[model samples]
Target chain A: MNQRSQAVRDLLEAVRAKGFDPGPDGPPPDRCWHEAQVEVGDPAQYPSVQESQES
Target chain B: MQVGELIARMEYEYGYRFQQGDVLLIGVNDQGMGGPQAVLPIEQATVEQQVQGIHEEVLPMVHRDYRNLIMVRYEEFDYHETNGFHDQFTASLDDHPGGFEVVAQYKVDQNRQLYQGYMDQQWASPGLRWTMPGKLPDVSAQMRELGYKEPASSEAEYLRSFQPHPEPGFQPLDQEQEVSHLNRLAPRVSVEVARHALATTASTESIEQQAKARQTLGHLVAYDEDARDAVAYDASISPAKKDALVETYRQAPAKQRPALAAAAGAAWMMSGGGLKAGRAIMAHAYQSTRPSDRALVTAAEVATTRAHMRPEEIQEAFGKEIGTDLEAAEAAHQEWERLYSSTTTQTETETVVETETVEEPDQMQLALEHQMNQPPAPVASSGPEVD
Candidate 1:
């Protein structure tokens, strides 16, 4: 791979280390575009304000 | 790779060179090191110059922290139509590491109403989401307020309340009991009775009462497209009212046209001289409505003709319209077939589904049975008759 492609791979690795699976390669399916309900990134890091309010 | 490297890669791979007024929002909360930071693009600069500017201005703000970093860009998009400017923002994070995922995409009209964006229910943490802070400063403030406290209602609901409610009591009729009652009453009422009532009430009743009567009649014939068409085309109704209805359907937005086409089709059916006439009126309407656009007229004629004729017969049918331009006719036919054939098939499928779902009781048959079972009323009885 070229420099930019390698850089993207390295970025993906760092994201994976944060306990959030970025899913399989080549971007999530197009259905994940708009109105997708899947929780992305680390839920622990980006905690819901609703959960905070309830607690 | 670091955030700076990732930004460079995005420019190289996606060919999206940074433009002036584009802002990058960096969110970092690792090791208590960072809050939110905004990076503005360098004006009238080369790619290298902009990258150098970003390195100088933005890198130090994040304190060289790459982990737990989220980057989003707010880009101004001009769609080149009426009130078409919008601020489109996309985020690159753990979930969407390969490329940026569109987060907040909306446009504000002259009235400051928002349109075209995903709902909060689609997001796991809607409160944390950021809108365009540069163009719509109030929206950003509202989103931040939402992060701290519960909102009374969604932004969409607030905007929707301003629009005129076309059909009152439309929601209550969704209940099983209401629908069943309507089904029982529907067949007993003739189209002539409803039309006569509306015509008479148009002159005598108050505006509010007339509106209510129209709404009631509309609901009564809602399930029967043919009955609705008959009412619309009735001779007793004023010509101006008919013209107004046609104009309203014609001026409806393209996205709403599919739903409103039933009303337009009713007008076409009456004016076009029914199914036996075979698309000549539709062709005439298209020609008259948009005479300047030859391609649109050709496409509409082809689509309407194709609905009634076979593929082999389309050219013969089109001989009257195009007059020996076989190539152009073939091109228009192919284009419209590609666009509209699937839509026609889908509509037919939906009709079958609707027919299966709504069970209509035969009121005429039931009335006949009741008359057969009951005793007849006394004829010519001026006083009590002695048997």
Candidate 2:
């Protein structure tokens, strides 16, 4: 699974484990979640967002 | 003489046996001012006679305020009985505006009277009452076994859970779960609102500030129907007045209105209100968000004052605040375990200090002893220090 999917799975697991309802019946996460989508990419393909310092 | 001797003496004097299941009458007269008397029946008597006897006995003891009388049967004098026993009958020779009504022993006034023939004691401190419907399994160990990441810390993990998608692929619970979660959070959220009104704000000592707090609470109730209904249940405001207040709140500007509503809810709670209103406010906040979202805004407000509290302290506070909400307790327990395990692992990874033949003193204790033994430092001189 992609990293985001894994994260979502873990969340669902935690909620169920805690005996809390996942939503429609439970509270939504604080962040805007409906906008999220699965992305296809390789971690090594993208350069680090942080700029390298001059030696 | 001991209490037993005194009791025996009274029993002998009154020609009555003072024992369990022996019904006694305690009555208050017409004026409702002084002590109505206690009439103990030495011989078997009718309920009517017992009540009449109380009035007759107390008439001499009290000033003129005796017209109607109420009788309560004390079935047993046991300590436990006094704690929960509450069944009484009232008899009046003339019409009394309010008749004797059965009030829960817990709800009785300090002087032992009901509030307007209305007596219901439904609320209890958190840990004392179980809030959830059934038993919830302990899944932390199982989850950990599955290699799921344990929380790093209690408060952090709790707050993080409220963050959007803290756990990837996390799905929201169904409608029933939502209602249950909101119900469980109701009391705590209400208390949080009160805490915010009294502590989160800059000041509440001034009359203007107090008035503003009250007004804010008013707005909160007005903004939501459930909250409004709760206030109506608790407060004696007329329907028309309640409608007017709600209308005004509706007309108010949207800018910073949420804060005002919260403040108003707190004010209501502070002013001898809150039982139902607080629950409504929390439920309203819970409903405003989408199913997949965390209850961050409201949860943060509830958890704000507890920012500096430790995990154990937070758990204890929650226990005291809401009693035993199974889900909340388990969540806290998991947080504690995660923090504990991580701490232990870190300790094991660090190097150990050297051991010597001579026993080493505790560094902290040694420091304290040395400090105690040392002479006081010299006061500084006005002139420059000597070389």
Which numbered prediction scores highest in lDDT against the true structure?
1
Candidate whose TM-score is highest? 1
Please report how far candidate 2 places residue B303 from its true position, in Å. Answer: 12
Could you give candidate 2's per-residue lDDT for residues A1-55 as a string of tens digits? 2211222233234434445444432222332111111011111211221111000
- Please give the distance, in angstroms, between residue A3's alpha carbon in candidate 1 and its true position after superposition: 60
The root-mean-square deviation over C-alpha atoms between each candidate and the true structure, in angstroms, is: 28.6, 30.3
Per-residue lDDT over B1-387 for candidate 1, one digit per residue giving the tens place of the 0 to 100 score: 222222322222111233334444333343322222334442345444444443333333333233333433334333333221112122212243333222333333333332333335555644332233222223234323423222213223322322223543222233465345445543324333334323323432344433333443444334433333333333112333333333333333332222223332333332211121112223322332222222222222222222222111222222122111223323322332332234344543553344344321222322343456531111111110000
DockQ of 2: 0.01
Candidate 2 chain B weakest lDDT stretch, 10 residues: B378-387
Writing each residue's lDDT as its tens digit, candidate 2 over B1-387 gives 221111122222222223332332222233222122233422355445544443333322222233332223323223223222122123242333334322111111222221111223565622111111212223346434533344333222322322222122211223464334434444424332322222212232344333333343333332333333223222211222222222222233443233323323222222222122332333333443322112322322222111212212222222221222233323432332332233333332221121111122322332443456531121111110000
The lDDT of each candidate is 0.30, 0.27
lDDT of 1 at B342: 42
Error in Å for residue B108 of model 2: 5.0
Clashing pairs in 1: none
